[model samples]
Target: MTIKFRFHPEKAVEAAAILLKLHGKPMKYIGLLKMLYIADRLALKTMDQPITGDRYVSMDYGPVLRGVYDLIKGQPVDSALPLWSKYISPRDSNYVDLLQYPGNEELCEEEEMILKQVYETFGHLDPFLVEELCEEEEMILKQVYETFGHLDPFLVAEWTHDLPEWKDPHGSAIPILVEDVLRSMGKTEEEIEDISQEAQREAYLDGALPKIFG
Candidate 1:
């Protein structure tokens, strides 16, 4: 059986606030969502848990934290609504502003470092451009899952090395996946499923089940 993950609205709001403060200006909703997703992904890769523990869904732009996305749009999410309304700007605006300072209690030192690193890496780029890049990354990630059926970051990185999209001009080790390469090579569905299931089983044994399942 599949298990659904829980969302922490307070943490989501706090995270958004932190990102806004770090940015030192208003951020577009799309951009803020991408930053939050990257931070959560990093946390999941390193700490065995995500910052908000929100459900991730693939969208046209990229992967999004479903609950947080709703909150950003000022939707009435029961747990996060009050706090979100209190500190976050209205959904009518394309730009999100931090109405209050976020306390650091919800985020740990490691999580902060990951968020900081993400900001330093992508903060200067246009949000729309970042979204476009993320769309490509998301497609690659889906192929990786379909081909490998696992969430092991190291293995995924190694597998992505052979793909044409896997470029490193700056020598910075960005995360990538290999399923697209497999697809290009025309691997059969049966073969892909068999290999993906085996890899997913290994991932589960490695304690990555909850992060993905949840």
Candidate 2:
């Protein structure tokens, strides 16, 4: 049986918020989505768990986190849980702006560091920007804007395509199982079994303990 981790929208929101804070302005939704996916993929490989626990899928762009994608598009979701719209603006011309600061209480130091490093590696590097006379204008234009008049989403997508776990889904999408990723990373079957069981246990705690304790 395929093992799946429960998606936590709160963590997803907090993760995206951290990236947005580092971005310091509106970002193309696609770019933000790619950054999140890369971070989660890295987390899974290193820590045996993804940060948001969102379902993964392979699409034309690359591997995507399904729940986070839905949240980015502002689709109707469980209202009881924290909505992505609470902290991120509705899509405006395919770009999303951070609406407010969703506190990072759910994120550990390592997760936050992963997010920051992903942004640095994929998003933009301002240190390479050419210095300008006007300080404010330089700050605004410090980051390189590729074809999209901002961070180039396509470039980020191209990089994500290189991940071994991502397969070309042609015109359709395909689910990417967590086991698939672990195996691609050369994890032994025994190690994968242990990780999957741990994931199931974590899911149970997240779902059952709240009701039992409350």
Question: What is candidate 1's lDDT per residue for 76-125, written digit by digit as tens?
Answer: 77767778877778765677788877566656656656665655555544
**Lowest lDDT 10-mer window, candidate 1?**
128-137
TM-score of 2: 0.84
Q: Which stretches of candidate 1 lie over 4 Å from their true place?
A: 127-214
What clash pairs does model 1 have? none
lDDT tens digits, residues 1-214, model 2?
5878877667777777777777878887888888778777767776787777888999999999888888777775565134677788888888888888856556665566666666666566321111111222112211212211234678788877888889999978899999989898888999899988998898889889999999
Question: Candidate 2 has which clashing residue pairs, if any?
Answer: none
Per-candidate local distance difference test = 0.55, 0.70
Task: Kindly report the root-mean-square deviation of model 1 from the true structure over all alpha carbons.
Answer: 13.2
- Candidate 1, residue 61: CA error in Å? 0.1
